[model samples]
Target: MAQKNETNSAKDQSNASVDQYLAKDPERLARNLARALEELGKAAAAWTEAREKGETGDVTTAPLIDMVRTFSRVSEYWLGDPTRALEAQTRLFAEFMGIWANAIRRMSEDAAADYAAPPAADKRFQDPEWGRNAFFSFLKQAYVVTSRWAADLVEGAEGLDETTRHKARFYVDQVSQALSPSNFLLTNPELFRETMASDGENLVRGMRMLAEDIAAGKGELKLRQSDASKFKVGENIAMTPGKVIARSRLVEVIQYKPVTKQVLKRPLLVVPPWINKFYILDLNPKRSFIRWAVEQGHTVFVISWVNPDERHGMLDWADYIEEGIRFALDAIEDATGERSVNAMGYCVGGTLLAASLALMAAEGDKRIASATLLTTQVDFTHAGDLKVFVDEEQIQALDKAMSGRGYLEANRMATAFNMLRAGDLIWPYVVNNYLRGRAPLPFDLLYWNSDSTRLGAANHSYYLRNCYLENNLSRGRAVLHGKPIRLEDVTIPIFNLATREDHIAPAKSVFMGSRFFGGPVEFVLAGSGHIAGVINAPDLGKYQYWTGAKPEGMLENWLPGAKENPGSWWPYWHAWIEKQDNRSVPARKLGGRRKTLGDAPGEYVRTRA
Candidate 1:
């Protein structure tokens, strides 16, 4: 009997330790669970009172109560018997799903009653009934697919230990809850709001949620910044005064230290996206494409646009071309005493470069020797979900909203992006970072996300109207310099790089530019998304390349022509770039004024509201 008692005690301790590990230590999960239970209890009490009053309906209070009860029960059950955690989680999920479904149905019915009118072109928001039907359809299809796949997984899964099985069960249950109808409405409020205008109650609720999210996001930013500064960083390259290029933003060109004072390499100009600072191309010693180009005996000069403000609100697409890009091109010409320089642009900056090229062509200027567009889009017909926000009505709304302010709000742009992947980007963080009082790790990409800049309203509005809505650039209908611009006009050698899995500009949309440009186009499909695809340096050995052989057909055919080679695209591009002429030219002043813009780089970027 004594031995049995000792064994039981040991088992309990073991179970407790396991639970602690599973929940991520003792402090966070334990207290969070307790507080959640208290909230649940309060919700239950509120529901009971509301039911007695008969003021509230079945939708609002019921789901809240159900969720609270499930959480409370799960918390209690886990505290008592850690081994039963899986069962508790499953029950919690099932109950949560049931409640969510009921709530969604109720909301749909309510929304239908409110928005039974004709669908105006401007007001053709997503229908709630349609959404409910779609949700059910998705749930049915997902379950059928998942179950078929799970049959195979479960065969191997049967051999798994108790803990692993528990986690699997928990995950499946979570999926079920996520598929609930109520969740459909909650998850896609932007879609919902389009069809059904939110009343005061919903508006207040949404504002509250947004406020909470903003607060939590700010906290996460602080933590991320603190953690990110600890990572190893590279040296800051010097340029013109006030134009100091750090490992962050690269800009300004006066006198640069040539590699050997041999002064014979041809003059080169680099064009980078203004959406982000130029340091992405010059991340570090090994990763910096600028460094690589310079090392290969080329006089490389990069253009850095001034981060715009209210004062620059009047700035338009033409201003960027004439003042920003054209100025830089001329500067490089004068600085190197060469007629033209190599130009490269990434993303929107690439689009601007193409426009500048068109302008130059119209003016009969021949300064551009070679132009490289990195993941730039000429046609945006298939620009994906981003199009949903670029409709005429929305553009007008944005124009009006920005007209008063003069600048497109950075936070607003960030919010639109967050809406794209609420599950992955927002809610998980809300649960982990805010509710649980834990800080998220600092990721370089997230650091870039935090470092956002506003756009001039005129520039942003023009881009949306012309590029996205009209699809003008690809159709050769875009007007530049008071003439219909055709990409064929600027017949320069072009190298375009696109990523396979870019969510922003899908490869198909970007690839259409190949046909648009009259120049010899060399297109390379890199592996990864927009940001990671561009930042893929030589040392990052996790990318594949496509030969761009298979004609751009469906995705499946496009896959086969693409060979899965090892190594980053950086070296591949470097090798290709080195093949170009390496004749030397003396550093001569460009056609632009030789006014010293202070020192190496400018300090205008550091100033923030």
Candidate 2:
């Protein structure tokens, strides 16, 4: 009788809190709801206007159809055998029963339940109310239970091919993430409290922001990840002093001003991926790798790729190699009077550099003394979730879509990348901006992420076919400029860096590629994801890295014997570079012989997508 009275008292307290929130501003709530509806109507109209103007493409249901077909195989495997189907159903039922019993026991004893709990790393259920409130606790546990059951079903499904199974798993995860209870208003306690406290005013503001973003996107929803207005390429972000020494249709070469009196004889050339601007390597003085390298007494030249448009649609791989890499090499030689230089590439830039090096080797040209590939993949065999979108059908569809525009739209690629980590990148922004009516905090990395670039049609198609689909680069089947080039032919010493938690280029894929290089390859594994892992500064003293014997065997085996070192890999790389060639020469000024086009951060990088 005492326990029952206690439970009733708790229920009364919850009801009183809800009543207080609802009754505080009834008139204001009604007014705000009306305003929110009006703003929502405007958002719908803007979307319709953009669609009618041909700014948005027709909705494609290909992914949904593919997901359904893939899951059918899993269903067939279970449904074909009555015994297996019964077992699967019984397991789920028993789990649900356990959760229910635990909830009952918690109500009786007024203690935490032990049946089910979210992983500690899951930020979605961090609200105290999720554990304190019985209703919310039940919802969280039920969702976790069902999602795990679905995943187990996929894992247990028999006779499914590897690709089919992989697609099924990925699609299941996507669906589960999308349907998470935390994404909804009533299901999320924090959002509910905020909505009530603001008397629905939060909804009004959110609707207004939604409409503005829709109109800004011209049709599609361009999710704002950060306050982009706070950052500018030359003034605040890419502030390292430099001057543009050379320009081509595809790229502009910017030679950074040297900080030290003397510099290494072999100037460093950085080839960043054209999918984004080059400022990622020069994001402010403190975080800028360019600034750090300049301070270390090295002449640094970076290729600032132009944000391509319809005019550059026909530019192919050969064109990027010739106009981008080779043109920069010519500019470097003229400026420094150096015949040999060290080269580094990031992400897809590294892939292109690898191809260019192989081509140079084939043509008997040896200007690059050493090569460093950061988070690059020469082999796509172990490439992560990005591979899910590279089947023949999808690639052909993408080709057809690009045929009309001449280049892939920036948002399309951005959306694909966001989908890879939708829980963190997509849904959090949705809850913050659209649900809570707040703008994202200013962040340099996210600002760069939002500053996207279009991919040339020919270049993008050739890349997808040669690298992701065919796996030709590592197989020695990749042909460039009418000549098939092999990785083993180019015997330059290589420094291969792979981030441990990279989703784009898995560490294993990078480790496997080390074996393909003919010359000595030093593989170093760094902690954290792609961006933070590579841009890590030595002073910050964050994360750790590993160095092992050579990357000959599997990563799992090599890791056991590898020595773990704390902090950034920048110093380690600097040491390795010096060991390669420690000779120094007098610091060279920008534009040794060639005329300067403009100041640093170049005009090409200033062009918005």
Candidate 3:
């Protein structure tokens, strides 16, 4: 009886989960769809008239033409009689209504709910705008329903190719973005009240900023950046004492002064992601991983990548490896006279570092003793939501955009990343900077995020098509320097750190590297998202990490055998590196032959994109 009761309870929970997924906005959606169809019709007619009269070359008509065409494509999927997506939505919604009706029947009999967790979408509805009035409440709920409906509609589509599926998902997400309460003046009562409280000054300022942003960024709006006054590089951020040992078109190698007299025998070289500044590792004293590493009695050197412009647009990933990593490695060896160095890479830097190491191995070079990758992806098969924009049409559009500018603009990339977590990264700014007319708060991470980098046309296009679109990197098709590069060539032991909640490189994606390697691997599942998970120092003492033996099988299979350990994963990494084949040696002097290339944070880091 107890076993039967347990089975029944589990079934009830599963049913409740499905109900939540399908429940919450059919009538509201139908009405909106009807309203939208009417507006689309009017716009289509007007655009058709403009096109027939040869007046459609104007900006407004140009955009209207594209939108009208997009509407036609969407209609074929949603409203077409043959493969009607709307029919599926209606059927699913009817099933949900049936569930609701049964729940009502149960309520009539006073049957108690067996308690289930609320979905994340419902969390935003707790606002007074949703709860204060029935109309607003319906609107809020309706928005959630429509957003889910759009997502479900795409997920349920039949006979769609990968490219079509990708495009459809992106279009649906745009629909959700358009319908967010934060986007509208009247729909968001809180923002309307904020505008009223500010006496329309907020609207005026928002308009001014919007115009300025459109002008400066070519219709791109920036959300946040770290003020130099608040985050001075040498003084507050990247304060770890270091001297530039090597300077190249691609990188500036900074060899940090050892904090201890006796350091690890092998020198440490950190390769940060080229997408952002190296200062992220040395952000502030409290969160500086570089500082922590130096204090651990290890000689350290870091590469600061150049903020490339149109001039560097011809440089590819091969160029990045040869000019960036190889050059930096030689300098580190030249400075310290240590041929073997413990190497570390963050994000894409890690990806490149692994590739470089593999190439070096193939070429009979074993200068790199060990490697540590933090929040990096070696496999692109599961690169998360960013894959939404990786289809042929989108890639072609991006290629055209890059061709116009000679490189993929920073704002364009930032916009995509921001849209991935719109509620967290975008809508708050919309409410604060636009509605409330408030200045952006001083935030280091946001500043780093906003301080975007351009991807060279040669490198960007190649990487996008080869790695992301084709998944060539993991499949052993990525050839750099005339020879095929495989992660299996990486014989050195690896310490791979991945954040549990990293949306950029999902933890499972990082774990896939375990299957790609040729030697021992230690994969630590850290707490928090990508950045937060990495920079979390031991002092913060927040977010626990999980540990498991480097074993075979699926991510799910591995997780069941893992043990959770509290606090920062940094110390664990330090201990792991120390336990490796390292011996104590006297701290080496800073610079030698390379005529100290300016100060620690080199000229390249200060150049604004």
State the lDDT of candidate 2 residue by residue for 491-587, as single tens digits: 9999999999998889999899888888999999999988999999998899999998999989999999999999999989989999999999999
User: Number of clashes in model 1?
Assistant: 22
- The C-alpha stretches of model 3 lying farther than 4 A from their native spots are 1-78, 82-126, 161-171, 225-229
Using lDDT as the measure, the top candidate is 2
What's the residue-level lDDT of 292 in candidate 2? 97
* Count of clashing residue pairs in every prediction: 22, 0, 1
Q: Among all windows of ten consecutive residues in candidate 2, which has the lowest summed lDDT?
A: 56-65
RMSD, one per candidate, in order: 16.4, 2.0, 10.5
Q: Which candidate is the best by TM-score?
A: 2
What order do candidates take by lDDT, descending? 2, 3, 1
Each model's lDDT? 0.56, 0.89, 0.73
Score candidate 1 by TM-score against the native.
0.63
Model 1 bad stretches (over 4 Å): 1-256, 260-264, 421-424, 548-559, 562-564, 585-601
Error of 1 at 147 (Å): 14
lDDT of 1 by residue, 359-422 (tens): 7887888888777778888778557555645555567767776776677655556645654554
